[model samples]
Target: MSAHTWGSLDDASARALMEEALAAATGEGVTFADVRLVEAEEERLYTDLRGELDERREHNAGLGVRVLRNGIWGFASAPVDGAGSAAAVARRAVAVAGASTGTAPVRLAPREPTSGTWSVPVDVDPFEVPAGERHDLLQRIVTAASAPGLVRSVTAGLNAKRQHKHYADSEGSRQSQHLVESGAMLLAVAADERGAQRRSFPNSFHGNTAAAGWEYVLGLGLEDEATRVGEEAVALLGAPQAPGGTADVVIGPAQLALQIHESVGHALELDRILGDETNYAGRSWVQPEDIGTLRYGSPAMTIAADPTMPGTRGSFAFDDEGTPASRHLLVEDGILRDVLSSRDAVARHGGGAGSGSDWPGAARADGWAWLPVCFATNVYLEPGEGSLDELLDRMGDGYYADDNRTWSIDDRRMAFQFGTEAAWEVKNGKRGRLLRGFSYGGLTPQFWGSLEAVAGPEEFKAYGMPCGKGEPKQWGFLGHGASPSLFRGLSTGVAR
Candidate 1:
C-alpha cells in the first residue's frame, strides 16, 4: 500500500498514515471500504450574578468500516492513532459483517459513487472570543430582566464544532470534506405571583461552527431580549390566563415554523413510513398514499427545504454520504409534493430519487457514523400578499403570538399543542395590550388549512433553532422563516 496525503485532517500527520492503511483494505477481498475522521473542538460559558460554572473544549476522531457477504451487514470502529491500527480495524469490520448474517442481509440500495469535500463558509471563529467578554455579555441580559413582580435569571452559552471527513467506496470514487458549525443560546427564566415562566432564544452559526468566535455572542445580545421576555412573565402574572375561547390568533414565524417542522417535515420522512422510527419521534400521519392529493393546508400554504439559505444551521453543500445539497418542494399549494429521502429510501420507492436527507452518514475504514437523515436547512413558508396591519384589519379582533414556549404532538404528527412567549392583543384593526401564555391547540391540517394570510419577507425572519430526530439521537441545525400569519375563528382558550 502507498500513502496519499489527501488533505490535512486538522493538522495531524496521522491523517496521511490512516489513508494508506484504508487503501490497503481495498486489496483484501472486502466487499466495500471508505475512510472518515472527525476532529472537533468546543467551548461553553455560563453565567448569573454569581459567576461562570463552565468553560471547556474537547475533540475526538475515529475510522469506521462496513462490509457484506451473503446478505448481512457488519461494522467495527476504533479511534485512529496510527497506520497499523487502521488496517487492523478494517479486518474487524469484515468479521462483524459475517457475524451479522444470522439475521437479515444488510442490503444497501445502490448509489452512484461520490467523491468531493465541502467546507462551510465563515469569516470569524467563535473560539477567538475571550472569556471575559462572554460573561459580560450574559450579565447584561440578566440585568435587564430584573423587573417588578418578576424573578429573573439568564443562561447564555455557545457550542462550536469542526468535522473532517474522507470517503472512498469500493467503486473508484474517493472524496473528503470539512464542515464547521457554532451557535449561541440564551435562556431566561421569569416568575411572578402566578407561576414560573421560561423562554429561550437561539442562533445557529450556519456550517462553520466553533469558528465564529466570541463576537458571535454579542450578536445574540441577550440584554436586548431579556427585558422583553421578563416583562412578559410579569404581565402574565396579572393578565387573564389567556381566556380559552374561540378567537383568531396571529401565529408568528417561531410558532408556525415549529408546527410545519414537527407535522409536515417529520411526516414526510420515508423511514417513518417504512416503520423504522416509530419508537421515539412518532411516525407520519400522512403517507405515500396521500402525496399530491393530501390537503395538508390552506391553498395559500407552500413550504420548502432550502439548503442554500444563508446563516442556516442545516445548510450544507454536500451531506456526509456525499450527496449534493438542494432545495426541494415538500409542499406546494397545500398539497404534499415529496418526502425527504435517503439512498435507501429512494431505491425502496421503486427508483424514486432523493434530494439528499439532512443527517445521514457513511463508513470510514474505522467506525460508522450515522447516514444523514431527512431534515430542513432553511425552511421557509411562502409568504402571502398581505400586510400585518391589513391582515389584522381583516380579522376585526384577536391577538398575535410569537416564538414557541411549549410544544406537544401525538406520535402520528396530528393533534398538537403549542404556547407562545410573546403576544399582543389586537382589537378593531389595531394593537392592544400585551398578553402571555397564548396557546393554539388543534390538528396539523386544521391549523395550516385555516391560514388566511402570511406576512411578506419584510415580516419574515429566522428562528435560531435546533431541530432533532433519530434514535441514539442526532440534532441538526434548522432554520424556519415565517411572517406573522393570521387565522380566523381560532380556538385559543386552552389552559396549560
Candidate 2:
C-alpha cells in the first residue's frame, strides 16, 4: 500500500473538509442538506503472461451535495473543493423540486444522530510496497500455468484500497473514517481446437476492519495461491461443459455470496422501487406494497444489512449523514420482510426507525460525501441444513460453479443468469474434473427456495470486491455472508 493513492490524506484535513461542508449547506437555508467526502485509493495491476503493468493505480476524492427543499431534491458534484457551494446546491435542489412538481413524492423517516471517526486496522500498507513485487508475482504464476495444450493467457490483477471518509450533518453528526481493502484476480484464459475459454479464481482478503494501515496487503500470501490456481486453470482447459438441466448445485462461498448480492441486494433497495434512480441505475421490482408481504426467497432465507461488521468495505460506525449504522433484516423465512432504506426511504415507507446514515455517499459527511442512497452493508443469508458433502451427495449429477463473470437480472430482480470461471460435474454424488465455459441461470425466489443445505462457517468465506448501486453511481463496499451451499434445479446454457 506504499504507492500514494487517495488514501493519502491526513485525518485533520478530512475533518476540516466535513466541518466546512456541513456549515456551508445548512447555513444556505434548506429544509435538509448533507455532504460526503470520499477519499479512496484504488490500485490495479493487470499483467499478461510476462507480467507487465498494463494499467497503473488510480485514486481520487470528491465532494457531492444532495439537498431537499419543499419536498424535492437536487444534487451537484465536482472533484475540486467546492466548500461553500452547498448553498447554491441547496437552492438548485429546491428549484429542481419545483420543476418536477407533482412527480415523485418525498418522504423521510426520523433518525437519531450518530457521529464518530473510524479507521481500518492493518499491519502492511499496500502502497508502501513497490509495484515490482506484484509484477514479478504475476509472471511467476503465468509461467507456472504453462504446460501441454492447456493454457493460453494469464491476466493477473491486484486491487488494493485505502479509503478515508469525513462526514458531518446538519443534525450535529460528525465523523472521520479510514479503512483498507486488498484483492487479487487471476483469469486463466485457455484454448482448444474448438474455441477459446476463460476462467478466474478471484480472492479478496485483509483490511476488512474499521481501522487499518499498510499491513493489510502484506498479510495475504498471494504468491502461493497464484501458483496453485494458475496450475488448476491450465488443467481446466480440457474440462467439460456444464450440462443444461434442473440440476442441484453445491456452491462455494464465492458464488453463493454473489447470488445474494445480486438478487437480494438490489431488490431490497427502497429508492429503486420509488423511481428515484430510474434515469440513472434503474428501478426495483419490489414495490412499497411488497414490503414485508412479498415472499422473496425460501423459508430458510434470513438476510440482513449490517454496517458494523468492522473492516468490511461497507462497514461504518456512523454513516455519512451522522446516522449511526445498524443491522436490519431484508428477508426472513422466505418473505420480503424489509428492503434496505435510507432515512428518506424509512420516512417514505412510514414503517419503523432507520439509520439515515445508511445512504450511499450519504450527505452530511466531508467533501460532498453524499446523501442517503440505498446500499447493502454486510448481508448474511442464514445457513441451510446438511453439510457440503451431504448436499453434494444429494445432488446426484450437477455442476459446481466458482467465481462469476458477467451477470444480468431484470430491474425487478426476477430471472437472472451468471457466467462462472470454473466448475466441475458432480456425477452420481461425487466431484469430477474441471470444466470450461460454465454457465448457470435461475429466478430469484425459485433459486433461493431450492436451497437444500448450507455449509458450515468452516466452509464459508468472504468474496471479492464491494457491491455497487444508485444513479450518479455510488459504490460502497459490501459483503455477502453465505457459506458453501447447495441448490436444486439450477439452469445452465451457452452464453452469447
Candidate 3:
C-alpha cells in the first residue's frame, strides 16, 4: 500500500477485513481469536535558542492477529496491504498458537458483543495544519521564554498523534475508533554559583496533553506563560536551600498528578497484584485479599478509573479488546475497592463469578504490533470540597511544592522520594520566602493517609505522559488528574 493511502480505508472496508481475518483464524481450529488493524500518523516539532532543533513526521499501518489453541496463546503481526492479506496473517497466528504449550486452557470472562464507531472530537486537525505554521508557533514560544542575561537557554516543542483502529473478534463484536492527541511544552534554564535551575510551563516533562486537537494546543497559552517560566528559573538561582525536617506540605496539581500516577495508579493494576508483571514493572504492594478492606488513604482520597471523560488522554469508546469503556471507582472512602482488570484477568481473579464486580475495561495495546494488557486509563483523584486557599488556611504553617524535578520510588511502589522545582514557606496562612531543592519522602499508604484536604473541582487539572510497561517495553500515553492537596506531617528536606 502507498504511504499516502495508509489508514485510508473507510469503516465498512475495515470491518469487512477484520471479519475475514476472524473467520480465517476460527476455521484454523483456534478456540478464540481477535484481529486489530491500526493506522497511525504523528508529527513533532522542537525549537530552541538557536532555532528549529528537530522536526519529525511518521506514518505507518499494520495488522495483528491473536489466537488461542490447545490452551496456548499466539500473536502475529505484519504490514497490511490489499484485502487478501488479512487471511494470511490470521493463519500465521493460528499456526503459532498450535505450536505453543500451556499448563492450562486460557479463559476470558464473557462479555456482551458490541458494535460501534467512535472518534475524539476536535475543532481543528493538527495534521491538516501547515508545518510552517507549527514551526512558527513553537519559535514564538521559545523566543518568549528566552532571557539574555538571567535565563541562559530556552526550548519549546509540540507533539501530536492521530490513530485509527478497527477491532473484530469471533464473538461477533466490531469496533472502530479515531483518536487524536496534542501537547506542547516550554522549558527555561538558569545557572548560578549554587547550580543550574530549570522551570517549565503548563507542566513538566514535555508539558500537558489531551485527546483533542489544535484547539487544545492553542489553549495552552504558551506565549503568555513563557516570561513567567523564565523569570522563575532565574529567581531560583539565588533562593535558599529548603530546610530539612518533617513538615506539613501542600502539593500543587502539576506535581500531585505524578504522585498519584506512581503511587495509586500503578499499584492498582491487577496483573501487578497477581505477579504477572514482576519482571518489568515489579509487583504491587497491594494483594488480592486487601481489596475492599485496605485503608489505602484517608476519607478525603478517592480515585477512579474513568475512560469516559471527554478530552482526557486516556478516554476511549472501546478498549482494544472490544470492551465498552466505562467509569468505575477504584478507591472510595479511604478503602481499596477495586483494581484495573482485563477480561482475562477478570476470569483468573474470579471477577465475573457473581462477585458483584466485572472487568473494568482497562485493556490496551500500544499499537497494532503489541498485544493488549491491563493498563491504566484516566485514573484520577476525585476533587474535594475546598480550594487551594482553604487548604493553606487549614495548614497555617507548612511548605508548598509545585512541579516535579526528580523522583525515586521503590520497585514495589511502597516507598518514594520526590523533588520539586520550587517551593515556599507558608507561615500563618501567608506565602513566604522562596526555597530551592524541596524534596519529600514517605511510604505510599502513609503518605496518602496524611491527606488533609484537596482543592475543589475548579482547581483540578489532568496531565498526560507516556507510561512504559511489558517486556518489549511498549509505551502508551495516559492521563493523571489531580487537584492541589494538603498532606499532614511528612518527612521533607533539601536534596543535597
Off by over 4 Å in 1: 1-8, 11-32, 102-110, 147-149, 202-216, 351-377
Model 3 / residue 4 / CA error / Å: 14
The whole-model lDDT of each prediction reads: 0.62, 0.63, 0.85
Per-candidate TM equals 0.85, 0.84, 0.96
What lDDT does candidate 3 reach at residue 476? Answer: 74
TM value for model 3: 0.96
Q: Residue-pair clashes per candidate, as listed?
A: 33, 49, 0
Query: What's model 1's TM-score?
Result: 0.85
Q: Write the per-residue lDDT of candidate 3 for residues 124-231, one digit (tens) a residue.
A: 887777877898888888777785467888989889998888999988888888899889988899886777999997888578889998899999888889978988
Error of 2 at 104 (Å): 5.9
Per-residue CA lDDT of candidate 1, range 118-183, in tens?
666656655555666666766676666654446566666557655566555555556655555566
What's the TM for model 2?
Answer: 0.84
What is the per-residue lDDT of model 2 for residues 1-496, given as tens digits with 9 covering 90 to 100?
A: 3222444456666666656655555423267766666777666667777645686767677766666656667666555344554445444445554565545556555655667766666666766667677667767656654543467777766667676766666666667766676666666666777666665554422113223443543444445655666666666666666666566677777767778877888777776766777776667777788876887766667776766766555666766556666677777777776666667666666643222324322222223445455666677776666667776787778877777766788767778888777787888878887877677787787888887667666666654345556544555666666777777777777464
- The true-versus-predicted C-alpha distance at residue 426 of model 1, in Å, is 1.3
> Would you give me the overall lDDT of model 1?
0.62
